[model samples]
Structures are given as C-alpha cells and as structure tokens.
Target chain A: MKFRMNPVYKKELKISVRTVRMAMIILGYNAVLALIGLLSFYFTFNYSFNNNIDYSGILQIYLILAVIEFGLVLFVVPAFTASAISGEREKQTLEILLTTKLKPSQIIFGKLLSSISSTLLLVFSSLPILAIVFSIGGIRLFDLIQLMLFCVTTAIFVGSIGIFFSTCFKKTVPSTVFTYGSIILLVIGTLAIIAVSYMIGVRNYDNLYSASSTMIEYNPPGVGHAINLLLINPAVSLLALLSKQFGSPSYLSSLLSHYGKTNTVIFDHWYAISILIQMLLAVVLLCISVRTLDPLKNKK
Target chain B: MLEIQGLYKHYGKFTALNGLNLELKKGELFGFVGPNGAGKTTTMKIVSGLLNADAGDVFVDGINIRKDKKKLKEKIGYMPDFFGVYDNLKVVEYMEFYASIYGIEGKPAKKLIYELLELVNLSECAGNYVDGLSRGMKQRLCLARCLIHDPELLILDEPASGLDPRARFEMKEILRNLNHKGKTIIISSHILPELSQMCSTIGIIQKGTMVLKGTVEEIMQQMNVSNPLLIQVVEGQDKVISLLKRNPFVENIAIKGSNYSIGFKGNKVEEANLLHSLIENDIRISSFFRQEGTLESLFIQITKEEEGEKIEV
Candidate 1:
C-alpha cells in the first residue's frame, strides 16, 4: 500500500512539459499528419459525394499512418528511456538513490513508466486529428480504442526494453545505441521474415503457369497477414490493432475467410490476448532490469 | 551504532579490503582517513550496502546489513563523492523524489522536504531548478537528500573533496550540526586537520589494513608515543630547558627560538611534574603543548614503507 509512485515518472512528466523539443516533436508531428489527413479529406469531398466518398478509406490511410507513428515511437522511446538508468550511473547519482529505502523494482518500474508516458503523450496528442478523421464516419470507436491501447502497450514494451538495456550498460550512449539497435533489428527482422515466408508460401510450383496471372489480393503480403505477423514483436503491437479492426470482412473483401476471428465481439475483443502478451513481456523485461540494477550485486 | 567485522572485498585478484574491522558507538562521529588505494571508500561502500563484502558482516544499530537489506538501507544514508541531479527539477522536487523513495509523500513529504531544504540552507532555492544551482548548493542539497529519511547513520565518502574553502566550511558545519544532534557519522577523507576538528574518533586505513584508530587525542598519543615533543615558552628558555634536563621524566631538552624542545619521556605523571617545575621556575610559558600526531603524517609514514616496492595488489 506504501508503493511509491515512481519519482522518475513524475520528473519525466514534468520534463516532457518543460522541454521545447518534446512539444515541438509531439505537437509538430501530429499537426503534419493531421494536415495531410485534412487535405486528403478536402480533395475527396470536393471531387464527389458518392455517399461512400467519406472517411471509409480514411482507416486504411490512417492505418498506414498508425504504423508510421508506432514505428517512430518504437525507435524514439528506447532512445529516451534506455538511458534513464545509465544516465543516473553516469551522473554518479545511482549510488545515493540505491541507499534509499526504495525497492529496486519500484525504481525500475518508475523509470519504465516515465519513459512510456512520454512516448504515450505523443500518441495521445494525435487524438484530435483522429477525431477529425472520424467526423466523416465509418470509423468505429473500437478502432480508435484499439489504436490507443496498442500504442500504449507497444510503448510500454519498448520502453521496458530500453530500461533493461540501460541497466546492462553503465554509460548512457552505449545503452541508447544498443536499445535503438535492438528495436530496429526486431522491427525490420520480423518484417523481413514475414515477407520471406509469404513469398515462399505463395510460390507454389504447381501454380507456375497460374503464378503469372496470380495477383496477391484479399490477403496481400502487406495487409492482414503481415499485420498478424507483427503481433509477436512488441515493437508492432499497434499493428495488431489494425488487424483486429480493419481486417474484418466488412473492412476487407470476403475473398479470404478465417474461423472464430473474422467476426469478433465488439466489446470483448480477442486482440486483448495479444495486448496482454505484450504487456506481460514488458513487465518481465522490466523485472529483469530491476534485478540487474540491484546495487548490492554490483558492489560484490 | 555501527560494526563491520572481517570485511573483505576484492576486485578480481586485487584485494581492496582485507579483514577490515571497525566499530562506532551511537552519537559518535568517526573520521576514516586514508591515502588513495587505502580501501576507505571501499569500506564505506560495503558498510552502506552499496557494495557487498566478500567475507564480512556489517551491522547498523544491531541490524545485519544483509538481512532485509532495504531495511538496513533505511537506517543508513550515503552521500558519494559526486552527487547527481535531475533535469528541470526544483530543489524541493529533488527532495520529494527521494522522500517518495522512503515512502513519505503529500503533506508529510512536503513538510519533510521543506525542513530538509531549510536545514541545508537551500530553502530559498526550493523553487529553483537543480541545474541552475551552484556546486556548493548541490553539495548541501545532497546532504539534505541523505537526511530525508531521518536515518540513524550517515556514511560519507570524501564529502568535502571538491568543495571550495567556504563550501567546505559549510559542509563541516552541517556535519558538526548533525553530530551535535546525536547522529552517528562515519566520514572518509584524506584531510587530517578537518578530521581532527570534526571527528571525536579517527580510523586510519592503509592498503586494506586499518593502521590506527581511536579518539583523535588517543590516536595522536599512540602514534607519537615517546616521540620527541617541543614545549615552547615566551622567556627564560634556558632556565626551563636546564631545569627540565635535571628531571628523570625529561629525556633531554633543546632550546629552539624562545622555546624549549623537550624530548618527552613515557609517564604522564612525570610530564605533570616537569610542567610544575617549569611553573615554579617562573617561566612565563607562551605555550606548553605536546606535538599532536596527524593522520597525514602517519599515513605518509606508514604507506611510504610499501610504496614503489612493486606491490602485487
């Protein structure tokens, strides 16, 4: 009951507000994305009111945007958070803090949460733009909800990874470089694997003559299946949201069918399982970070 | 109260502390003086639970450091040589951060932080960002941070190493104040004069071994036992020296400047008799003081023996 709300979280939150660059980055990014979305809306409405000439296509556009946003978060969160612990070490302050009554778990969790919150602020800042996109209709609340949830979960997981690396390296630069490096490897490596798997799977020798006419559709290499593949990597937890929301039969063509998943409860979303997995992995990594940072072991 | 028994620490094959033993009573301020590579910081680190000893037990207020280490940490406060700070954070917020670590918050936390800042004389700088503060301010704030938990023992490793003259005086005053409040403090430094002024007892460790430890006066007595001492007087220097030469307690005497350089003998009662004889000789003694041994002098004397002899560790 006496758990300390991480001072790291509070300090980070304060710093996030005070720093000019944080505001510029978060606000400026959302504004640019919003400007693009609004300009597209103007062009579409000006051309035709074909009843469906609304934000129906907006989800796909923003889904791509979501991936970009989450990708940026994945790369940036670690750079910011990975140095949290090691920064303390470099400043030579970690020793004094360790002497406090604070538990190691509390300190690590606090640092992780602080980093996640800063990254989450960027995700949350895009809410008004998202709301504008929804003004044209066809965008369900569940879509936005899933988007928010995935963004938070992915940031938490990535932030945990960052903090874990921070604990491993005593200096800030190496921890930061290593954290960003790992994220790049995770994101790109998974994408490369999925692409390769889809390429090989689609290359059936029996359909060689048909392969010339074979068009990858309904389940494009870059769409639903690719989205599903991203669920395993915490860096792309946000992609699972698009898969859950936009991969529906209503959103996609009825050409591809999968049981028990094409139609999911609107409220009791199945993607929660993937979200939980990502959250669990983050928590576990954070626990390991806490353990590694325990100063008594270092002294020995 | 603090006790470290058989503390042994090694970095690879290089031993830092070899069978080091130390004790301090409640409300006692002990100065730990040693040359570089003398294991003073290593000993302080282990005792503070910032480091673990290879083979030893550290107890603070009768509580073992290893058993429920966090609880022991609550009883001990440590201020390393260089303290750190957070970005864009006020002095009050910095204190609150550590206060929260100790599970103190809200009104209780604010009250404590306010009091600590006031104690460190940084109360006016409560709203100022830590980065904007001066080095001396940071040092004082660090001291305040350590005392946030109202800890029983403070383990300071070279707290005054980089401080300027005024800042060092401020730090000494703070330590003296804390010691006056009956707090037990173990401070490690290489400065002999500051330790003599501040600490009631002193421990001199050389190359992982504590060469000497006791009350400041007691240590000086032990270190300079039977060593030559000069008793300076204003006038009648020859009469005092000749009179003192006749006494068996006086080994011999040499007149230096206007004072008598008396080679002191072993017995305290004999010294008292010699002093009485000087008074009877109408020697208007300007100053009659024994040459007090210093930590610096002893450290140089002891460590120099093994210096440059190709020490394996």
Candidate 2:
C-alpha cells in the first residue's frame, strides 16, 4: 500500500529518531532480546540436546520469544504515547500547535503512528533472534508472520489507550498511570470477571435443580458464558492463538479449557476476532482524543 | 482587517469577555492595553481560533472565524503570551516543520526558513537547538515561526512580558519593523510608553468591557485634557491663578510645587495669547507650555470615569 505522509508524523519521527535517548532505547531493547534468547537456548540445549535434538523444544523457545516480545510491547508502547499530548501541554506548546491549520484527527493519527512506528522498530530489530526457530523443525515462516502481526496490532491498541488518556488528563503522571491501569483492566481484570461469572452461572444452574437428579446437562451454561467472555478478552484470545499454533493449550488458555475447547469455531478464529476488536478499540480511542483536543469543536 | 462583535465568554460563571466589540483596519498597528484579567488574552485566543467564544463573531477579511476556522488560521499568526519549543529540533528544522505544516515543502520551504531566520536575526544560530537559545532569542524565534506562513494579521499577546529592558527594546524594534511592513498587528501590553511609541491606535479594556478606544489625540480630547497648559511662577501666584481662571480659554486650575497647570482649549494663536496674558499680568512666570497627555494618564482617567459611572448607576 502507498503511504500518505502526515507532516506531524514526519516531524515527530524526526525529533524522536534523532534523539540520543532513542538510540539508547533501541540498543537496550536489542540487548535484552538477545540476552533472553541466548538464555532460553542454553536451557533448551542443556536439557533436550544432550540425547535427542527434539523439535518440540525449538517450538517452546519460539513461544518463549513471542511471549517476551508481547511483554515488551505492553511495557514500551505506552511509554511512547502516554505522554504524547500531555507532555505537549506541560511544555506549553499545545496552544501554538492547535492554532496551526492541521485538523485534530491529523494530530492524533500522527502521534499514534509515531508511537507505533517506534515500537515496531524494536519488534523488527529482534527478528533475527526469533529466526533461530527456522533452523529447527517446528515453527514455520507463516507462523512468525502471524506473530509479528499480532505484536503490531497489540502495540496499536495499547498506544491508542495511552493517547486517549493523555488527552483526558492534564498531567503526564496521571495520564501514564491511567494508561497502564487500562491495560491491566483489559488483560487481568477481564479474566477475573469472566471467571467469577462462570462460577456464578454454574452455581445458579445447580441451584435450579436437585444435585442427585439423573438429568443430563447439555452444553452447561457456564461453558457457553465463559466462551463468550474469552471471545472478547484480548489476553485470552492471544493465548488461544498460541494454543492453536502449537496444537495444544498454552499455559493461560489451559486454565480455561474446561469452559471450552481450543478447536471450537470461535476459539479457532480467536486471532482474527481479537485483532478486529483491537482495531475497533484504537479507532474509538483516537476519536475521543481528537475531540478532546480541538476546542473549536463541541465539548460533549 | 478584523472585526469582533458581541463577544461573550464565561468560565464557570466568571465572565472573561462581555459583549466585547472591536475592529481593526488594514495596515493598522493597534495596541490592546488592559489590566490583568481584563480579557486581553481571551480576545486574542478567540480571534486566533484557539478558543471558543460563547456568543461572538470574529470576522477576518469578511470571513466568519467560526465558519471558516481554517481560513482564519491562514490569515492570522498568533504568538501566545507563554510558549515553548521542542528541544530536539534545530532552529532551522523548527521553522521547516511549521512551513511544511502550511504545505510549503522542499526548496521553497528551505528558502523560507532561511529568510525567517535572517528576519529574526538568528541566521548564525540556525543549526543550534531551540532549547539552547536565550529567552530573548527564543522570543524572536517564535516570532519568526509565526511569520513562516506569511500571515496577514499578527495577534501577539504580551510579546514583551518578562524581558529585560534591553530585550524589551529589541522586541519593540522588531515589532516596529513588522508594522512598517504593513502587517496588521494587534499587540497587548501593560507598558504604556512602549505602546504609545509603537502603536497608532490604542484600546483600553476594563472588567471584560472596552472603556475607550481611539487615537491618542482622540482619547485625549475625549478625556477633556486635549491641551493642558502648565505654568510656573515664583511671585504673584494668586494673580496668576486668578488670571488663568478669568480667561475664557483656561479652566480646571490645578496647583503643585509653585506650578500651575490648567486645561486650555484653543489653537496656537489662543495658546500664544494666553501666554502673553500671563506675561503682561507681570506674574513672574518661570515656565509655560502645554502638557502632552500620556498613555498612563489616559488609562487612569478612563478607569476613574468608569468607577464614577458605576457609582452613579
């Protein structure tokens, strides 16, 4: 696809990429990725390579690397965007920028694009380390492509959350805090609520009938309820995607397997559905941020 | 040219602007002088399209600011009272960034950036980081940034605030040059003397309303102090006072430290006649001349009149 450049995006990229701090961040990010990959390799070789060079261990290494990349995306993307708008306000530059001819959507899109681009640089920099699985026999190139796409989508989604809060709050500290808080709510809090709902549904079903009755329970209410919850839960969907990749439930999704099988239609399609949900979230958040920024527009 | 009519704004019940009406003609250097919290910044923001007005219409070259906000952005260059710069950007790069925002690119943008740097007297420091510049230099750089797009109208809110005397003088000179170039400038400041020197017209606002607006001479005439004649006499002070009071051209006698100052309404001939009368009376006159009404005095008189009008109401 052809790229239509935004001036704000171009300028922000120039400023960020030219900084010594960005150089150091890229160096540090690669160093951490290299160190983790080496350690995982050492452990996998010491245990499995002594007798049999098992391909299963290589797949385990790929999963470890993917999880590490995902964790890094969660921690790094917000740092770029949480202070995107609030920092401009703090530096006393937002007013001058607002007076320019650019629309509010261009401003927000530029911030998000710059942030996502920075994180993508880090993600792509570690591709060689993730490429170690190619020497082994388990992971395919298509799997790696899917993994990278997932990382990019995750960064866009998380970065939008940061930009949204940055516009809502006046100070950078609160905006950053609330951005991380939102990630936690999406990842952990959603699962906790779904679990509680599943238990409550099962308890209500049992209460509706006597325990000794020989009645066959068809597709229990709790299992269907949990499946719906997992369908929308980003963390769960991510785990489900990984489970489908390795032909077994990953650690997180394993805990929720009693509610539903990974091969079910919705579970099998979790990756596409999760990406759709994240894209929708990014658009909604960016709209709110743009509306909050332009004073000439209606407040409500 | 710009016109604002029936402008009203309130922040949580505290009125910032109340039915404010103001107009500026093309090629006019209008000084917007007011006390703190008198809505100077608010009015400028509204004109610049940076803030929304509750009930108002700001027209620039016959285009409504609300309807064509983007068109207003192209016509007006706004320099806020307080601002900042990106530390990572060089002076030249900063200008280029803004030029690109206006859709000027490549060679044209580079030429404009160099021209702007020269205009602001920062040609030697084009490669220097923006955050490394001194406050005066930064102010000039911001002014250069505002002119990158060659906007017709410049709205500067307290451009000289927090500057040293030398820096303030330099800023005043720059503004004078810009005004001489036929740019319509609306500058707000508390420095009355500076405004008097640089601005052709002055508007004084109080409590979110304009108290008076006109040329210096017109405002002086409105204040009834068009020609205040001051005379000093060492001897026959009572005779001098009596003589001035009896003359048809002299009125409002005020005395201080062996000097008599009175309001005189007449042409050069009448002024010379009054002086001759003082001399013929043998009042031992020490000095005599008409007092040029100052901006400070006009401000004080307008505020006092407003106070009186409020009390009467």
Q: Pick the candidate with the highest TM-score.
A: 2
Off by over 4 Å in 1: A1-4, A18-26, A47-56, A193-231, A234-240, A248-276, A297-299, B231-265, B269-292, B307-313
Clashing pairs in 1: none
TM-scores across all candidates?
A: 0.82, 0.91
Model 1 score (lDDT): 0.75
Model 2 off-target regions past 4 Å? A1-4, A202-223, A249-257, A260-265, B220-228, B234-238, B247-258, B263-273, B279-284, B304-313
Give the Cα-based TM-score of candidate 1 against the true structure. Answer: 0.82
Model 2's DockQ score: 0.65
lDDT of each: 0.75, 0.82
Model 1 lDDT tens row, B1-313: 9988988999998889988888899999999987788898888888877788899898899999888796788788898888677646888888888887777889999998988888889999999989999888988998999999899999888888778989888889999999999899999887678888899998778778776778877766666754666677876765865676678766777765876667776556666777788889888776766676666776677677763222111
Top-DockQ candidate index: 2
Ten-residue region with minimum lDDT total, candidate 1 chain A: A252-261
List, residue by residue over A161-273, the lDDT tens digit for candidate 2.
Answer: 99999999889999999999988888887777767777887787777655546777544464553455555456665686687778775554556566544456555566787
lDDT of 1 at B200: 96
